[model samples]
Target: MRTLPIFIILLGIITINSCSKDPETDSDDQTKMFTDNDVLEEIRNNTLFFYQGDTATLSAAGNSPHGTFKLLFNQTALDALGADGKLAAGDTFPTGSLVVKDVIRNGNTSFYAAMWKQPSAENANEDWLWYEAFLDGSLLVSIDAKGNGCIGCHRANTNRDFVNSFDLH
Candidate 1:
């Protein structure tokens, strides 16, 4: 019957759609596009929006991996902060938010640290995907890692969803 053929076609379409891969959930793809050298390139090209319009915010995090740095945020993160660039303690950035820390040393930059909010049941970084890498694309914390070393310090700002700059600054 013609109806039987139509049902088969619809089933095939549903199967294909259901099996399609979601780019956002793929760790490999996220690392390639967001956490790797492409991000360094973006920083070098000055395409990212600096947070709170601050060009160079001296890193309060002293004698550590991060030296002098500038904070940058995507539109989603900016919206979470509102026009005042302030959030009451415990406010968390929503999914799709991106935050970057451009680390500079002696007028030369060689590291780009970032966090992207992607909620998942296994996420341990407060639903954020942690990424910290050097300019050469070497990873300090791989995309698949849970970011334990990072979360340790970030816990100081636990109320701010593990982000320190906005709350401390």
Candidate 2:
């Protein structure tokens, strides 16, 4: 009986120590670290590269001679674009998220994306789009689910005066 209490205390200490390190269970969460380059790289590596055509495809070449990119549709993109009538699209149109700020929200993460060299048939400028989470200034994991909706929305902007063109240059 005398030694039982000490054993219990030791077990409790070990359990507490193990629990303290668990990221999922710990109350004090360590903020994820992400930089603009990290965000850009993740977007590039994870996002499904698409090309322009009457129908968007999985390949990186097609009507989109300059190449195309896709992003999710969420509040971030709407708010950013809504707030600013224009956003930079590298050197051309079709890709507005590069230097632009189009974003969408997916759970706790935010998605931001853009592309360059807008396909001529679609417009004079490239098309860029994104879905990002506006979670203050904290870092979060953003998955690039650049699905049909992305292409469909950009398709609507096929006209010369489509809202896709922010004239940010």
- My TM-score estimates for the predictions, one after another, are 0.67, 0.28
Residue 47 accuracy (lDDT) in model 1:
48
- Model 2 reaches what TM-score against the true structure? 0.28
Question: What are the lDDT scores of the predictions, listed in order?
Answer: 0.70, 0.36
Task: Give the count of colliding residue pairs in each prediction.
Answer: 0, 21
- Give the residue spans of candidate 1 off by over 4 A: 1-47, 62-65, 121-124
Residue 124, candidate 1: C-alpha displacement in angstroms:
5.3
Writing each residue's lDDT as its tens digit, candidate 1 over 28-74 gives 55442334454345445544677777786666553246778888887
Best by TM-score: 1
Q: Superposing all C-alpha atoms, what RMSD in Å does each candidate have to the true structure?
A: 6.1, 16.6
lDDT of 2: 0.36
Model 2 clashes, total count: 21
Supply candidate 1's per-residue lDDT for 130.
75
